[model samples]
Target: MIKLPSAFRTLLGWLPALAVLVFAGMALAQSFQTQIYDPTTRKWVDYTPRAAAKFYNRHGQSPEEFRRQVVPFRTAEKPGTIIIDGDRHFLYLVQPNFQAIRYGIGVGRDGFGWAGIVKIGRMQEWPTWTPPPEMIARDPESAKWANGMPGGPDNPLGARAMYLYVGNKDSIYRIHGTNQPWTIGLNISSGCIRLNNEDVSDLYSRVEVGAKVIVLMQGAALYKGV
Candidate 1:
């Protein structure tokens, strides 16, 4: 047995409680760090995409539901059409034989949600990011990139981008890859649809310019039997 002075024994007895308090404090700090006050919304919002990505990278990938997979999907839309069920955070590339390649996606938050039929106007690899005028006015941070941000791993539009168009006009929205893969399955983007880098690359390769895209927003009629 090891013997210690009275003071040392007392200190040793308090170690477990100290450890619990330390861990609790750490958890509380992390929670606070993950949220931000939104003046426009007058609420605190979860703003932890970067942090979440780091955590998931250390722990594991995003939820199993968000992983890419092939599933039985029945839709009247022809093969090569892209159907996005934003409410469910799933994007399906319609295939022949009542099948589809499904990928988890991050969709528009609250006021930004929309549903419409569009076509792929163009595609780019490692696409540059040019913050829209409205985005710059809304977010000072975006103002720095008003001119443009060159494409790379750190760019928000991770590995690829497919621009959307309504007839001959640009909708200013895109189906793109995201640097923060942890955002998949969450409602977080301004208006664009986001997929993980690997998944986006796979989708980009399969989709062609001028392919039809149907976006179903929340409460919209989702395809049956998906």
Candidate 2:
């Protein structure tokens, strides 16, 4: 029978313990994942589920109304046109039958109702929020929002924003991600459509730079064409 030397036996005995320590260290390093920082305050914020859940609960909002504002949609429609149910808070990327990639949305708040067929003219990453001159004029405090608002977890636009445009006009209105995920099912946007940050981020990645976007107020009728 062969036997391990004493020194070799000792090293072998230590391997399992060494492996566990290495794994524990890796996990500890990965514990810090996402960050939300405010340069002005010189602070770093952690994205923890409990903190987010607590913020949602503290807001004077009904939990149901902010649940991504989505409902089942007929996605199998013909591929040429997109179906937007702003009234119902869902957008559908029509396919062929009666189904779609449905997404929850927040429509215009108070006086920001819009009805039209617009194309996605321009797209941006962490878009700068330039308060329309009109918005600044409405309230002097809004001037801070001008000169372009930087993107972050606290930014009203959340992580992503899709700017809707008509021919020569950039609709002051937008379709964007919101920090206020709790406001999802509600029509509480100034003039833009709101989406959960993750959802909007996904949508932004799927849609292209010049995708044709058709936003509708009424539920689309069954398209009866080839």
Candidate 3:
């Protein structure tokens, strides 16, 4: 047995309490960092670590529902076709065996939603974002980026972007990664389909230019076979 001086023994007894206090302080600081100001709501929203962790697995990746997975999906579309079910917030890449690789997504809000068949006209990695003229008019803050916002972690397009087109013309819509991972499974974008950075990167690698993309907007029936 080890014996210590009276004062030293008292100090040792307080060690566990001190550790608890230190960890509590760290958690409090992290909670504060999650506070974000929302221009639309005109309020500050806070996301507790526990809430964020619920969406993630022990590996720090999205949970099973949000992570990319192969699931039984019956569709007549050929393999390599992309089908987006806006209401369900799911993007499915059709496979040959009546299965598809499904990834969680964030779709457009309300009136911005649209259903159509389009093709992936182009793709880019860490692409720059140039808010269109209409967006600038609707959002004064976007005017500053009329030229273009350089691609980076902070950019709205987190990692990769696939541009959609109608025949020869750009549809002005995209399927891209979002810096705001929490937005997945929500309806909040202008018209783009947003995926978490990791999932989007995976999708970007699997999909190719000229791939068929069918978007089924909220409340709309599944397109044809899809």
Candidate 4:
């Protein structure tokens, strides 16, 4: 075998490292392309579908900053608990080791904001929209949906909904997905805490029925970074 030059040997040594990095990058690209699963259709889906993409594009929205992520958070809640800071427009799923998965959310409008401790009484995939009696009274246009609106892409409750309850009593508030993703990070819902369709689907897969949910009002302490 011929002796290799020092520079050639050095380059050869780096080939393995370079190969590792190339493979790592490929893996990341694959993960980035496929976002999460959609419970509505029981299929894996992209981060943004056409309608959602078009809506966001029309509103000049950039969703990168608001995407869900796991972050270090200081919270007294247990691992399985869900905590919503309405004022901060964030929801935290407490995890072990003082860390939590956080998602940007759309909260109740000014007068509809609320604070309470409740449990996820139930969950629905592609949940139907039933305009409560009071809702119909408030918005007469909702009367068309008096019976119920079947869940679909245009449905107000995007893909999944977690019904909140206070000891068997329906709170009538939901932790659900919104078709209008631009409303996230703002107070604009009718008393529900809403996340993006993909975010809610990811959350629905992680949380089980009866999970503890705490919604904090104005004066409540916010989750500080760890």
TM-score of each: 0.72, 0.61, 0.70, 0.69
Once fitted onto the true fold, the runs of candidate 4 whose alpha carbons sit more than 4 angstroms away are 1-55, 58-63, 219-226
Estimate the overall C-alpha local distance difference test score of candidate 3: 0.76
Q: Where is the poorest 10-residue window by lDDT in model 2? A: 217-226
lDDT (Cα, tens digit) per residue for candidate 2, span 1-226: 8898999998686675445333422332211122335366799664344444554588544234334333345543445445566666666665445445677676654334445666677777777777868679988887987887898887888888877766644655567877778665555666578788887887777776556676654322211110
Candidate 3 or 2, higher TM-score: 3
Tell how far residue 92 is off in model 3, in angstroms.
0.2
lDDT of each: 0.78, 0.60, 0.76, 0.75
Model 3 — TM-score against the truth? 0.70
lDDT of 3 by residue, 121-203 (tens): 99999999999787899999989999999999989988999998877657667999988887776667777999999999999
Model 3 residue runs over 4 Å out of place are 1-63, 219-226
Model 2 / residue 105 / CA error / Å? 0.8
Q: Model 2, which residues run further than 4 Å from truth?
A: 1-81, 218-226
Best-fitting candidate, scored by TM-score = 1
Task: Give the lowest summed-lDDT range of ten residues in model 3.
Answer: 24-33
What lDDT is reached at residue 61 by model 3?
59
Model 2: which residue pairs collide? 74-99, 75-98, 75-99, 75-100, 76-96, 76-97, 76-98, 76-99, 109-189
